[model samples]
Target: MSDILKFPKDFYFGSATSATQSEGTFEGDGKGQDIWGKWFELEPEKFYNEVGPYKTTTMYKHYKEDIQLLKQTGHNSFRTSISWARLFPEGHGEVNEKAVAYYRDYFETLRENDIEPFVNLFHFDMPAALQDIGGWENRKVVDYFKEYAKTCFELFGDVVKKWFTFNEPIVHVEMGYLHQYHYPMKVDAALAVKVGYHTALASAYAIKEFKKLKTGGKIGIVLNLSPAYPRSNNEADLKAAEIAEAFQNKSFLDPAIKGEFNPLLIELIKKHDLMPDYDEKDLDVIKENTVDFLGVNYYQPVRVKARDSVPNPDAPFLPTYYFDIYDMPGKKMNPYRGWEIYEKGIYDIALNIKNDYGNIEWMITENGMGVQDEDRFKKDGMIEDDYRIDFYKGHLKWLHKGIQEGSNCVGYQVWTPIDCWSWLNAYKNRYGLIELDLETQERTIKKSGYWFKDLHDNNGFEL
Candidate 1:
């Protein structure tokens, strides 16, 4: 084996997955149907080959076995989300006993194996009941979310010390309300703003409640921050990049970390007459409460430029209304995934947090590569996913650089531990250290998994 790359002794190294993505028992354990479950039943064709959320990595049954794989891969920690519907089937009123039992056992199992469990409260699995009730668009959903979050802390707090209120909150708003990728899909900027606001409010409320309970834990909101890049240094391109950054990254980053919404974002919303309905007290709640930590999901940087023509009909829409995505030429790219390969974006984010945002303790929560079905490369029960290994090496190098440069980063968790469902992409984009065999419930560790094990054993990798 090559000289292993290891992280600091205090730096956490693990993998992550959302409940809806990996746990296949979507309809089991009294789990009410989520939007994804309903979406598959309604129009399965929209998904890649009609594969639904239920046909996933089946982690519910295999978490015990999977924990062994994680240990073998040198994972001292692992991150996963609890299904909201699993915890509270109707999204607000009732807590499912079976889910509570399953999760209690799940955390226990992880701890038993000496794997620190980092649990997230929400991960894009909206209960269908809530969607019918206007989802995040309705302000009442905010209270329901706070209740759910409090319930989770009380239920699982004993075992879980690190809690994330939401994973990629902006992505949920952009996809569910601004874009038509997720279920309950609507293309309404006004609704999107309302949803994003409530998400922040809910996060704040969760933090407030967690503090009251005195869980001796940290609370945070996860954001998929892609440092926006201008197509050219020209004024228009540079301005477009700034706008894109404000719309995507700053929208949540400012609110959750700084406890205030972005002024430019607010003005843009007002300019478009796209302000959300909000009560006065909500702002006070957010201002008083902020996350204990942040989960930074840096997959790729965004390339943007000003739009040539305002999008159709002179009406407001998502960020696409003001800016357009422009692929930068002569930039290195990741072959496995079509996303731009800009490892420096990680350093920039870390520096942004350190210098601008007070450098609250953070982590590289979700960074990994997604390759097309990786099963064909299996050799003697293992996958030779060297590309995935290289992806880890490239990103980890930047992560180490950030840590050395006073970024206050604490941990690194890849996007997933096993192949899991990826929103509309479903199983199309495979990102996992362990290869999951869908047909037979078999799992084989990829080469990256071995590399991670050695890295963990050595406490840092040497290039």
Candidate 2:
């Protein structure tokens, strides 16, 4: 019993996937095109091997079989999103019945199998119509988003008890504005701040509207929180890391949970003369309508050292300016994907919640290693993913440690249930329990699938 790895009573175990990443038929079912659909079309060279949103695992057709695999792997819950364009073809004019029917049927299947659906409203798939209207940068998009959120609750709230406003609101802003990796990419911090502020305001409005319905469902936002680590204990390095974390993680974390913006973030915004247009009345809405829960996506921690000199004035810059990613010697790495792997990061995140963030309930919404060109593992009709299994076990150990130490973490949900398309690396990093053959739309369970079943059967895997 001492060696048994157990979670608290009713702790959840699930897997997560987004609509565009898995549900193919991007244009079928009367779905309006999203940024992914358009970007791949306008600039095919930007995508890997010219793959677009149309070619996915076809979960829209195969969810029945996929749900079976989910149950076989002992999932008590699952997370999926509603494509904004799928329901409202143009950002906010009319609802598409066909899109609703597909998701209604899809969500019902999970319930029939005793799996609770942890649904999200948006996963960065902005409708092309919205984009034409300035997307999140334009304040009008927030009202458009809130209208979409309300529709989702009215239609699917009966089944999806847990609803997330956005998968990762900060990620959308940073990648779209600061990093220039997303659609409509622009390296303008001022505009990015505007977008971030709007997304947060939209989330607050959604929670307020949700309460009016008296649906008794929980509302939350998902954030990818990578704890920042200083390369050394030096004060300059440490301060830089703190600012980096505040900008990246706490910018969303504070407002979503604590109902207030961190002062440190406010200072940076002011220093850069990038104050978002915020009405005085908006502060009350944010404070009063904080999320009931949090969904944290932890992949890897960032190790940074302070810049020796000011960043190149002419070079493209982002909030990551105060520090640079330091490649520390002897740091463990996943050789297949080239991402650093440190299990302790999970434990530290949990503790931060308990000690600094007021012990709010949270779930590990996404955690998995993405391996490039995993086709070599395809043999005997199954992808033998021993490495993936090891990755899961290692993270679980730290998560278990978090529970033992009395953090308020409630569950763990892996990055994906089946291999799907990521933002830039389309089908490059395979991080799924069920290996999907993109050609035939066939899915085969790897060894990890069976191992998870055993873990779930026993209420925990052996530590």
Candidate 3:
């Protein structure tokens, strides 16, 4: 076992959380309303169990204790996003000094505990004021985001060396404009293209600005890359999977890493006549400001097959117009979260990066299984999350294989440190090393948490 599955000594082990999901004070401490806060007020039924951002784990007040818990779980590094509205109340001009002080103290405390902080600028929470003007749709929001990135660098550049421009930028386009899961729920394909373009452009702008600071730190964007697999080797099915990969994965990955759009994706966009308006300058910005590293957040692979019927010409364009998601028979699934558990998907992603794109420095920024009714697993004083342990081991085994094959993978960070409020899922599915009792905000390390500590200490575990 020692000779078979050992991890590199320098390979980082940690977990990740976003500000909106973990920090409870959405409207307090001069934090202007984010889209989540406003959306809850507008439509309370949209969230599960009627839980909102205001009732999260209260990481704002309990960050010190939380960091201690992170250390207890064997996290040598942790990633969290900075709330844009928390820093700039209106999303543009004045800096919220209180929020600044809180983040500074938060980073300092993490550093004091010997845990590195991987700070991200934006998650899904857009400032409501910005959304009013047009969140990622309007080009002006891109400039505002660039300014916000600069402010974070000026303030936290001394301690925070690892920075990410955005977390899952594609979600804003796919969920908001296409699937209608996010705020400003519109199903316009053209509008989705515009939002996606502006998001990739904004990431480049942020990277350019971050480099200008000369902070001697690395910066990149976090992308959720789910490899699209065809249902069969048939030509039609392979074409469907190719289109899915182009739209979902390469749309952001190409621009961030390759500094260009995939030609196949561009061809599809043009064929559908959903091309976004852009100028030479925006193209130049994207081409010139490629990222220094990459962050991958992979959960499951998407299976696709050719559409049974042709799309109506008069109807609005959709990505699924060319293909349909195929549920592979006999696929293993996480019963609670309902996501497929194909561990080899991690190896596929790593090899894709190594062989197709240059093997750039990268890390598993987020990967974990979320379980519903997790209380059922509680045993003794802690939750006996043996399933969660198995989940990690399966993924790690493949990830170790990738590393052995010269994939240049850097670290592994789970989706969360503690069970906190998910976006629309709220508390329905819990994915954390530590369980948080929402009533008392009490945190107790789960059995998986203890097991992870030993893995971190040993640098590997027996399979």
- Scored by TM-score, the top model is 3
Q: Native-vs-model 2 lDDT?
A: 0.88
List TM-score per model, in order.
0.96, 0.97, 0.98
Error of 2 at 227 (Å): 0.2
Q: How many backbone clashes does candidate 3 have?
A: 0
Question: Which residue pairs collide, candidate 2?
Answer: none
Model 3, 167: alpha-carbon shift in Å? Answer: 0.8
- Taking every candidate in turn, the Cα RMSD to the unseen true structure, in Å, is 1.8, 1.5, 1.1
Worst 10 residues of 2 by lDDT: 312-321
RMSD of 3: 1.1
Query: Which is the better candidate, 1 or 2, if ranked by TM-score?
Result: 2
lDDT of 1 at 128: 89
Candidate 2 local lDDT, 350-375, one digit each (tens)? 99998988888888999998887777
Q: Please identify model 2 stretches exceeding 4 Å from their true place.
A: 26-28, 313-317
- The full ranking of all candidates by TM-score, starting with the best, is 3, 2, 1
* Residue 165, model 3, lDDT: 94
The lDDT ranking, best first, is 3, 2, 1
lDDT of 1 by residue, 1-463 (tens): 6665555667788999999988876444798888899888898899987788886888888888899999999888899999998888799897899999899999999999988888998999989899888888888898899999889989989999989999998877888787788878788878888888889999999999999999797888889999998889899989898899999899988988889999989988898888877777889888889888999998889989889886886664667776789977788876656778888899899899999899899998899889886777778878898888887888888888888888999898887888888777877888888887778878888888888898788788778
